[model samples]
Target: MTELTPREIVRELDRYIIGQDDAKRAVAVALRNRYRRAQLPEDIREEVTPKNILMIGPTGVGKTEIARRLAKLVDAPFIKVEATKFTEVGYVGRDVESIVRDLVEAAIRLVKEQHGRQVRGRARAQAEDRLVELLSGATKKRKSANPIDILLGNRPKEPELSPEDRDKLVVQQDDVRTRLRAGQMEHEIVEIEVEEVRPMSEIPGMDVNMNDMLSGIIPKKTKLRKVEVREARKILEAEEEDNLIDMDQVYTEAIDRAEQHGIVFLDEIDKVAGRGGGSGPDVSREGVQRDILPIVEGSTVNTKYGPVKTDHMLFIAAGAFHVAKVTDLIPELQGRFPVRVDLKPLSVEDYKRILTQPENALIRQYELLLGVDGVSLDFTDAALSAIAECAWQDNETGENIGARRLHTLLEQILMDIAFNAGGGDAPEVTVTVDKEYVEKMLGADLHRKDVRKYIL
Candidate 1:
């Protein structure tokens, strides 16, 4: 994050999201500010907060994509929530605080994965050793773990073997270990005990997780199942990694990471923009905004892990603002989002660039999807122009869905070819989508769109 200057950030963003330069520059500064704030004095750092951004644009534009990509670039704990999903207090709807809870959950998973990777090599070796014991049927003896077994003297009674027999058993186990390590016993079946998923009782409308509450108090139960050696090794390896990890450290670091570096993307915020005192469906719009205001303004949210501070966390709100303008939202919520950027409607050339540019371009995606079926997909430059023109014309005539119109157009054009590929052992085929083919397939739809201009 420190190395990513505002200029470099925009350059990186260009790889996936095209255009929206204003939006890109706004987010770049916002992201860079987070790092800048960290360098301040302890007393000064507490006073500085993230300049939350509000992105206004039409549907299918790059609003959410920008926030999502920004979060990924920094590897922050990110979660996107719909503003319409929550309601005002007294309404039976989700609370806005759940946003922080969910963010913390993502943080926990992220930290666990990082720690798991660090310990994976050691865990793999240990799991393989256990697998060899299971496969050889010359397993080592272990003490009983259950208190009932200790109390009733119900432990397994073992027959004492002579030293010569034990020596012979060791030799046999050595041969089995060598084969197991050599990947020669991957298909062999083994029986292992896997932990069962814990079920917990919970009451409705509660924020607390009942399962998490009882996790420490209840002892986990395991059941034996037969699985191939390859699959068993994975299960055992995961358990071994769990044993190696310090979960308490994970919990502590995760909470800190989420509190300091979390990103909450509030999408469809325009849906909740309304002046107060309205009745019926729009009554709760301002109410919802009022509720979201506190979180963005910095508040403490309780999670299963611990309390998380929203002061340092970044909040990026986006909406199409087609029906309700940004001014329609309550002033308090509006003030919380200090930075605002408007994403321009995609042009025909922008659509063409979107279809071809970016690391994960639309045309490249379709090509890759079909490539798995041994179908080589290619699109002529003229075909791309035709598709982009169709998308632009459709947006002008009907819904202004920005770059998303390309997906609909391309899917319709390639529907038959995708359906027919890889059904059986057929020779590889090459499909080049040309302008004539696009016109032939979408002629009817394009004609209908043309007719829409005549409607009013």
Candidate 2:
């Protein structure tokens, strides 16, 4: 991440994406800008704000992919949210702040994993110590069973062990540990009590209310469980390691990581961009945009965990905006997102490139899927051309779903191949889809406007 230049970033994106050089260049420069800002002095750093981008494009044209790949490039906390989903349940819908909560959760998990890798040596030592304690307890308990008294034909025996006997038990404990590590006692089940974490949903504002109203009426019970030594060691050691970690520090570090490297992709922004407002859906839509505006413009949002400031967080918003122009958004919201990049619709050549050029091309994906059932699939150059042609034709006839049309076309073309793929050892199937093949598949049905509507 630190070493990658804007050009290198674009090069990386080019491997997966076919074209859309403008969008790619915009994101690449944005990413490099983050790196450049990091090199600046602390005094000026806080004054700097991220230039949030608003991507205007139709569906399935790599708007989401660019943002998604940008997140991966920097190992940032990335979250994608649709504007429509928020207005469904009024205030009960997932609060916009939950996006920050999710980002924090992602940061915590990422940091915790990195810390786990860092503390592996210490954790292993702690686990071994616990294993030794278990072995010692088992050895002492076994020896206290009084074999001497049983051999004497008198079952009576003292429960307490002498200090000398305890010393011998310690030696036996070491021997047991040696055997344990050697897998000499793998089948032996040792009962051990282990605590399990329960999923507790914290109701916002309920704590204060509950304490005042129901404190004396009820008490919360903690949770616990029982398991074997092997399982318990892993669980307890992990628990102990988390306890060893400073959560306040973790939170601070997580917030910093999120602030510095977070990527928020706001999808379907145009859905909420219209000017009309009332008691109907438009009111809620406007409300949603207003709510999102403050966060985008740099305000502190309170979450269940803590408050996260959105000032420096990178926001990449995308919308088809076919019905609504970018200017349709509220002025304040529009001002917050200063950088606007309009993505061009994919041409026939672009569609063809998408199918054949990318690492995870549609053709390659379909071939791999069919190959799973011992089927060999190969598309002739003509067949590939036919598939692309049909995809383009469908888009022209129906909704222009961009590259996604390839999915439907390929699925229909290989329906039989997918269904009977694993039924038997199939022969090598080479599909040659030329102009004729495209016509045959589409047939006269494409010309029937109503038929095309229903079929598509």
Index of the highest-lDDT prediction? 1
How far is 344's C-alpha from truth in model 2 (Å)?
1.4
Name the lDDT of candidate 2.
0.75
lDDT string for model 2 (1-456, tens) is: 456898999999999998899999998988888888888899998888889999999998999999998888777888888877765335766656666777777888777766777777687677666666665673223333254555555544446878998898789878877987787765555544444444555564222233434434443332444456677667767866876677777778788888788889999999887754334446677788887877788888665446788888999999998888887787899988888898988887888889889988887887787767766666677666666766777777778788998887777777866787675556655554455655566566345342466664
| lDDT for predicted candidate 1 compared with the true structure | 0.86
lDDT tens digits, residue span 1-456, model 1: 455899999999999998999999999999888889888899998998889999999988798889889888988889999999998888898888878888998999988999999999999989988887787776644555675665566667667779998898788789988888798989989999899976677554566778867666665667788999989999999999999999999999999989888999999998888743456546677778888888889999876677789888999999988777788887788898989998999998999999989999988998899999999988899999989889998998887888888889988999989999996688888998899999998987765554665677
> Per-prediction RMSD in angstroms?
2.8, 7.9
- Once superposed on the true structure, which residue ranges of model 2 sit more than 4 Å away at CA? 87-92, 120-194, 204-246, 275-282, 423-456
Candidate 1: list runs displaced more than 4 Å: 140-162, 200-207, 275-282, 450-456
lDDT of 1 at 251: 92
The residue-level lDDT of candidate 1 at 169 comes to 76
